[model samples]
Target: MKNLLLTFCLIISLTATAQRYSDQAYLQDRAEKFDLNEETQNIALLQIASDRNKAIKILSENGLLHPYEKKIRKDFEYRPLTDMHIVALSRYQEQFIYLTDKAVLSNAWAGKFYIDHGIQNPKGMAIGADFLTLVAGNSELRVFQNGQKIWNTSVNNLNPIALEYDKTTGHFLILTEDALYQLDLTLKTMEKVYDGSNLTAMCYYNDEIVLGTKDGIQSLNRKTFALNKSNQKLPWTEITSLKNIRGALWFGSTKGAFKLRSDGKYDYYASKRWLVDDHVVDLEKGPDDTVLVLTKEGMSKINFEPMTLAQKADYFQEIQRSRHIRYGFTTDLTLQTPGDLSTGYNHDTDNDGLWTSMYLAGELFRYAVTKSEDAKLNAYEAFEAMERLTSLPDLKGFPARSFERDGYEIGLHANGFSGEWYKKHVEENGRIWRLSDDEIWRWKSTTSSDESCGHFFVYALFAELAPDKAWRDRAIHQIKIEMDHIMDNNWYLVDWNGEPTAWGKWNPKYVNSFPTNVGDRRLNSTLILSFLQTAYHFTTDEKYKKAAEKLIRKYGYDENANRPATTIGFVEGEDLSDKWNHSDDEMYFLTMPGFVNYSFSEEQKTAHFNTVKSHWEVERSEKNPLWNYLFALSGSKNIDSEESAWWLREFPMDLIDWKVDNSHRKDLTKIEPNFRSQTYSEVLPGDERTLHLHNGAYRNNGGSDGNREYAPYIYLLPYWAGRYVDAISAPVPN
Candidate 1:
């Protein structure tokens, strides 16, 4: 009885002290978008080049020119250079030399027509201090100065494929089908420098002239004329173009473009992530230290803008507000045409509640840290969207997975019913949609326990941090009914069909049925306990507290919940244990706040904290900011702060669902496939590989055609949570 009274007093203490979050700022290095934005430029940009200072000049196929400086796109011009068909371009001093299909044209310093060379049948041209070297008619090499052909010559029966003016030697290097020739500045003296066949592109790198061939690249020393093959393995062997930008060797290949890094490995820019298509046409250094990859389809400007963590949060907030929110729910945008943002439209997804809850929770954390009015309104708007989910469904205390207008739910199940799995589970099992009592709306049913985890996460945060007392009380009330529903249904989330949803089982009978190796067994136990604890903490409801105590004391839930993540691996015959479920990791991390913060006793808190730390150890390699910040709630010093910051800094600003394929990369060290599905020894940074939401990051490569855009809540939640928990600070005064 004495122990029982002590347990009751401990529960009371949890209600009093568990809700407060400390407001302390730990300053850390901050790292941090666009409008006319990435989407617009993704469609329009064609050839891209930059000056020595990295100021960008973009040219569309139709001759529109866009000059970019700093972060702003300056004034543009339509067909600014000439009326003739422009084939190529080169920057000389402050002027641009446009090589038209028939002749040559020069643009004035500020984009007006300055002079026309009238050099007929010009194939390409290279500019020098006072003369323009024009390669014409496949064999003729001519030098034009002040709009007059000063000298002209022809190579002996050698078909020129490419031409480059060597700045160091002040001589012209002509690449032919089988040989390279050096022509003097006077356009008279010519010498056969190297005899190599199948050469495709040429560039001057320092003291050597690098030649790209069908096999690989070889550098020819200008002084000795000795050609040496590049020993480093390349991403793609068939090199198409080569450029030496700021002393770095950048090359284009049939597959993609890459830069030879100082470490000998290549920084590959492939797929839609870095280019419009993998078949690259050119490579240039872009404005603000960006990389411009011109592909067969269009051009991609990879920007490396520096920003603070707080600034990054604001940028995503703007993106979410502008594109991702649909009927108050943060959502994915379905693009009708691949890589076209104009064709994007929001549609209902399977995890609507889960996604919105994450986004809402993020806004609340933002409010808690900065107290911005916009954050409050954003949180409130999403809170209303979630409230509607509970009310739309007819079942008492049961929230719908999502809701839509009555007629808009047409072909809802039919749209997804192509396979036997959908037919058997969705069509044969039970009704998945039901019309609301108001007759104006329809709500989806069969909400999973993971959805409940998300719902409870935001609700508890709202109850704890929302400024208005009424709002906090409303959140507390929602938690009470949700908990009561689960408990009333025998520790299961009973659906509209008067049965438990396939994944909503939290009772000990169902959870313990799985072997110890399965993740669901441990995750479900923690989730239900967290739900019960949160309900009791906010509402001071004795029933919720008692139910939690019963689950722990009678069902060995404490032991089940404390199991380390390392034990979870493939169990030979178990279907659920075939691989590590990233979604389960998502559920566990989402449930962490309530699980650790609302512990009924000091001992349980310590045990749960240790469990969290153990789980974090398993996930530390991924360097997930969300998981790191969630673990920071336990007040542990080993939160992997630098890893978390690196993740935040490296995350790509372009959240477009581009088709990213890194399978052909030579740099990645492939590993034996494991239960975790980690394809490499080291995971790539966010911008280098496919960008998935909470359920991704371990895989080396996979993506869709650029047809969707993910809501930024993944970055937002972790960043704001980091700020709220004092793991990060506000912007460092610019």
Candidate 2:
């Protein structure tokens, strides 16, 4: 009867809300990496046409509609070495017709072309329904139908600079250096639409003729041809090209390409995330409603395919296993070259245990929600790796940060810390490595409080949720051993040198040393109390309970834990305590689940629940799915479910750390940088910004050139946790 009651309570706690939207097709946009092998200055124009048969075949063979479909369907066709100096290009019946300095020609068709006619020194060209038009030598307008000259007219003094076919008016629009003209093919006459200079590009949009100029966009009424100057600001003033794609006006400027949204905002695409170069030369529509932006070096095809959040989860799961796993722990991949996955090599990190715990906890929740055998297997594998961390150092219960094979540099610098600052810190704490009993490996030491927080959080879940009694017993044993070591060492993680490692101190004197506003004061107090509560809840150890009560009553740890996050502000002259520590946000939230679940009394649960709520209220603006979902799991009904779903859907399919820069964007409203380090007034969407696991999500910009790929645990943890809590739904068949 007692076991039945416990199981019932577990189910109620794990599933805390009603089910949300099921999986259905939604547009998920991702950038496909494509670049040319060598540089060329003679390239004239880029043209793309739909290749449905090729796209379908590639999709059918790989069962993945991505990577190959875009490559095969919308691949750019460019001249390798054109000494003819191609001046203009257009698509006619799925074939490219290009005009050069000497003559006009077809890529696949070899009929005697423009030069054979009277056309010479063509300035620009456009393809019509049954004919092709060009401003020949900027002196005359000529048309060709069925590979034969059809019509000719004079526009010599106009000095035509560009040409386009307006299907609505059945006329070829021509742009001169200082004027716009419409050439009626049927009437065989030319009429000037509007006189304008500095007009670089033009496109038909929303029943109006839109023009790109040196300053910004200008539009003209098609009927009256009255020009209206645009008040809209762009990412760059020098508009190079324009295209109307699916009702949205896309502007390609010297900086990047941006789509004008209906909300008067711009969806800016810049950096290596979207283009090979910021100088967008042309914009065109591609297969499957994709948008192609052409640069001097290469083209960027933004593919928007139908996908559910669940499908995205599966994709990331495969990525995690294939690229990130090292010795059963979710590890880092160091690349020899930027943006090149082929050069990536798996490496051990200092927080292997912490990172793996988060991933294992995610898998645990996944198994709870779906009963997936794969999730169970993944969780157990990560648990074994963490289990090794504790025992590898040969200390009673001290956990190593990470481990690598012998003969690798085992210094503080090799472990990612460097210079005199880290050198002094490591010297004060002793060496950072200890050899295993077998003497074949070296384990990194000086495990910090966040590592302990992660272990306590995940091990507590394992003790309660593991399928077999043996696994549950093992988890409980780990909790007991670690808690005993802390208590025995006078509330500090005593390292191999018999001293507390830096950042692992939790004694009253150490934690209370900082002022209350200093984040460390509140953070360390919450961590130790949570550890004790978790240990006591699982083991029913009176000593663990006594240690927690003593801290609460004598050291005021309960009060410290209850302090609102708003109280955590800068501490002058205290480098560690000053400003906001984004990493502590991870530690606090990760520890809160264990802390709230294993509270000794109802009063403690209520107090800690408010702490989680207070922290979440501050973080609500970021729309972070993980933080919001975890807070909802703690029994808050005001969770931002819609925002969470938006974040998950907007997260880019490509996880490569491409260099991203949003500082040049005019769409964003910058704020004076504050304590939280929020640079922008509004947070960018998940796909628009760079995301690192421990960094602030509100950061508008900053990334390296595809050198690193973060573990997918950042998404998996929040997604599975939300699912387990019934805040998110499983996919339903379309």
Candidate 3:
């Protein structure tokens, strides 16, 4: 009996040793699979050693490798949108489309559905098919039409990574990491359809299952499970997504994308330059066979027509110049004599005021590509002409006038001048005026002179780009003056100097009041926060930090006070009586908290983060796409939540209500045709009959007038938030 016990103990010890080695082998295999070098491997091992479960989890969560265990661990169940399984759907005739990112079901029609994952819920629009399908993690399969239960009896233990309905066979082909399965929808059963291959992407083509694997494309007979042996030259690598576009098989892979002809030939398309990045996460065929490619950075529209080297070079040059203009580096905003009119189409209007000319010049410059010098010259001349207008000085600052014709000045138009000047001056200063103009307008208010945040922003940009430190210093000084002029004793800012002026249009209670006399706390809080944020970026000044924090806390950051909700429309003063200007207030305020939180103390950051998160949740739930997009771009952690994804995919619905009225003037009513210039109020769903509102926001030259302007700049926000890139530089966790 003692000898028997010893033998048993030995057996147990051997089993334990084998298990340990197995786990270690699994970890090493995954590390290599995910391209983790020795250094990352060591770090991962250390992380695993500290908490074997958590370390294993982090690695697997980051797609390093599939966990060794059969069941997913509880702690690492939640996946980011990037890692989630994506189900792209288009209806035959329905306007609403459905996107199932992992377990989240987002409808383009009804907005976002806040259904929990792993739960059996029959949500979203139902197709007339017998079997309902959904994607969960790597698995895509047919479930019961009413619930989350899998329908295929033979599909047990099969880990499906992708699925497509084979209309020809009346079945669904499921692509797993290892193999593929064909499920008979009518029979409610599945069979091992294909073997001896590692499948990646699958689609139905001409009543057959067109399978894309590591080897190549293989077509299976619809009736019989036998593979077609005659033709199999479909070249694909790491096929990520496959779509049937105009009868051709459009397959997007990690290496690039490809189109397989019905005749069995293939054309390779590298997405590195053609698309956003090498990793084409998804692809869909848009109008005219144009491919909508989604990548890690963003989405891009790719025209399949191959261009010559010269054409490519010209296209890239145009793109580069457009990018510069979009970032507000330079633009033409002036009318020049004897215009060549080669680059942009010119139209002369009766109201050829300075503001109009400046706006026209900017519009032309924004659209100009080949004739860049002409556009630049025209813009420079317009700025010079505007500067020749008569001088009028006010206590707060000089009024930015609207009309400038042959060197004559006109008083500022209320709503148009302030915002337009701010946008043009700060965002695109080089095009507006020369860097030397800073000294000329050093103390001037009127006389086509620079004042306000618009001028300050322009000067700042010029100083940053210019060679001279003196020019930069002068710009900074001008910014200081503008900051002082707007900020009141209570830390709130007055919009403008004139009584009930355009500046005070959004701040009605403080209308027509000097900075000292103004008492209203309006959307200027957001504007002031933006100014301080910009100032901090330029000078790294502690004063800007203090001002930003003060304004944030006083307005909506605290959450305890009955402060105005950032999601609501802005009405001037303390009056909640009038309907809020939802577009202007919300868009500005939505991004402000995130900006402030990035630079604030830990406690303050937490408060602002929570406030922004809460507001985002509400905005997302309400299907406000513009706000949702901003919230997502703001790096809201809750974006990874199932609820946020559902909302974001549906919020574009509100944009459909936008309309444009050409009759409405900036002075009479806030009407801007450019979708980029619109605030939340302008885009909000309401009965305010105004021209120039687009049913859906229009994207011009890959950029919009409003929040879309900041899309390119968003990449810098994460770095500014103090998140170190390398693990060694990160703060040690408690």
Q: Point to the candidate with the largest TM-score.
A: 2
Q: Give Cα distance to truth, residue 315, candidate 3, Å.
A: 5.1
Q: For model 3, what is the C-alpha lDDT against the true structure?
A: 0.37
How does residue 89 of candidate 2 score in lDDT?
58
lDDT of 2 by residue, 1-734 (tens): 01322632454455444446465789888766455432222343343333333221111111111124223232233333133455555566655565665556654445444444455666667777755555456677777775677788876575665687877767888876678888887787888879877888888888788888888778898767898657446767788888888788999998888888889788778778778788887777767788877776556788888888888899999989999898899986778887777898887777899999999989988987888999999999999999998888877888889888876733543365778877886677655777788999888887888899999988987876678789978988888888888889999998888888778899999888888888888888988988998777777778888989999999999998899999988778888765678888888888877667667887888899888789889888888888876676566666777788888887777777777777776667889978888888887887778867844666667878788888888888888887876667778788
Cα RMSD for candidates in order: 6.3, 4.8, 24.9
lDDT of 1 by residue, 1-734 (tens): 01222332343333333232222323221111122224334444435566555545655545544433212243344344436566566776635566776555554544443345454555666776565555455556677766677777765555677777767668777788788887785556888889987888888777878888887888888777797556436777788888887688988988888888787777677766666567766777665556666665555666555567777778888989998887899998878897667898887766788999999988988887789999999999998888888888867789888888887763455234546666677656655777888998888887888789999988987876788979878887888888888889998889877889878899899999988878888999999999998888877778888998888899988889999888888888889998788888889888986788688887888899889888888888998978977776644555666677778876777788777777876556889978888987876778778879987758557788888888899889988877766666556653
Residue 22 displacement in candidate 2 (angstroms): 3.1
> What is the C-alpha local distance difference test score of each model?
0.74, 0.75, 0.37
lDDT of 1: 0.74
Where is model 2 more than 4 Å wrong at Cα?
1-19, 38-86, 93-95, 100-117, 132-136, 144-159, 184-189, 409-416, 422-430
Candidate number achieving the greatest lDDT relative to the actual structure: 2
Q: Could you tell me how far off, in angstroms, the CA of residue 624 lies in candidate 2 after the best superposition? A: 0.6
User: How many steric clashes between backbone atoms does each model show?
Assistant: 3, 2, 33
Better of 1 and 3 by TM-score: 1
Pairs that collide, model 2: 23-731, 339-706
